[model samples]
Target: MRRLAVLLLTAFTAALTLTSTAGAHWHPKPTTAAWQWQLQGKIDLAIEADVYEVDGFEVPAKTVSALHRKGRRAICYLDVGSWESYRPDADRFPESVLGRAYAGYPDERWLDIRRIDILAPILRSRFDRCRRKGFDAIEPDNIAGYENKTGFPLTAPDQLRFNRWVAREVHRRGMAVALKNDPEQVGQLVGRFDFAIVEECFAYEECGKFSPFVGAGKAVFVAEYSEPLAAICDQAERLRFSVIHKDYDLFARPWEPCFP
Candidate 1:
């Protein structure tokens, strides 16, 4: 019995070690990297992008595997801070956690981020699916709910705690996570998140707020909808941001890379 106990203890220790080391999977935080963000139409595989950010639930595992075969990384796009009515797991969210309707998005509603106990398990399940699909990183959207009218009386500290928990959960699953469009909290979050994804930063004149990410050797992926590439490419080049002119719909076409 003593010998058997020793063997089980050794196995348990090794299992724990493996789980801890999983977060050590190194994801490079390049200042500039070619990337594609397509969430609406069929994915175009010939975009010549180094990274592909796609909807986590809609995309198949085989697609992520294919990106890996092509020497490209895949970032799983999941809305951690909102509940989309169209999602497969939409019904899992209780009414209490649903807040105001997401501005401009008819099918989405902001989540009561203060309910971490209720939200963490659901978010973890989403993260697990992404991991199983072989995504190298995650793009968690709507993280800056406090800055918006989420109808939950959310404070900045509440947002920080939720965001940090998100980072920790994603890292624990061995995938890098991006801080999506939360420029105000970048200073506090840059050290935790591996990269960032922002939309119309140049148009909003908030591009400079993300300099901390570049300074920390982290990539900042920006998508400009109204601004022409010619107008922002110079500043993008100077800032070392991976900027692209993408339509708000996020189809494969209308993609104009600043670096290209």
Candidate 2:
């Protein structure tokens, strides 16, 4: 009986240790990390970057393996706030939860985020695909639907609840999660998200709002469509943001990185 008790205690200690160690894998993005966003076309294994955010579904495991082999971090981009007609599981979403069409994206429609019970499982399955593909992090885009014409009557509190849930689940899976846009909630979300992924913040004069993330020692990755590198590079460098200039299509092509 004494020996059995000792073995059980040892097993409990081992389990506790493993749990703590697993949680520590949630690494924050580097302050000056170089990142490439290539959501379409063939995977460009030759891009110069420390991190690459690609489509969670389109990218295969082998491509993620190749990126890992090069000591590069792969971030899976998943749409959590909007339902697109192109996804493999598009039919899985019922019409009741689907809202108005996303601007400029005729096939995509905003989601009724209040239906977390229904959407959470779908997002978990999508994120699980990313996890199984060995992605080091997740860039959940279209997360700022509350600030848009989502047609769901979504309020700031509702967005907060969903975004926080996203961050919690991502961290629970031992993967880093970034806050995409939604600069208005930066202060509230900085504590929950691992980093900030901003687009056109400089152009919109919202770049300064991301200071909370940087101040919290979390990375802020900014992507601009038309801003000249010289125009924002210095300002971005001063803010320690990993800035990149890419085309709207996000085609696999050469991109300028302002990583110092």
Q: TM per model?
A: 0.94, 0.91
Residue 136 C-alpha lDDT in model 2: 85
Scored by TM-score, the top model is: 1
Clashing pairs in 2: none
- State residue 85's C-alpha deviation in candidate 2, in Å: 0.7
The root-mean-square deviation over C-alpha atoms between each candidate and the true structure, in angstroms, is 1.9, 3.0
> For model 1, how does the per-residue alpha-carbon lDDT over 84-176 read when each residue is reduced to its tens digit?
999999999999999999989999999999999999889999999999999999999999999989889999999999999999889888889
The alpha-carbon deviation from the true structure for residue 253 of candidate 2, after best TM-score superposition, in angstroms, is: 1.4
Q: Per-residue lDDT for 1-260 in model 2, tens only?
A: 99999999999998787577447755665476578999889988888888888999999999999999999888899999999899999998999889999999999999998899999889999878988999988998888888889888999999999999998788767688999999999989998888889998988989999988888988998889988888988888788899998999897775888763
After superposition, the stretches of candidate 2 with alpha carbons farther than 4 Å from their true spots are 1-22
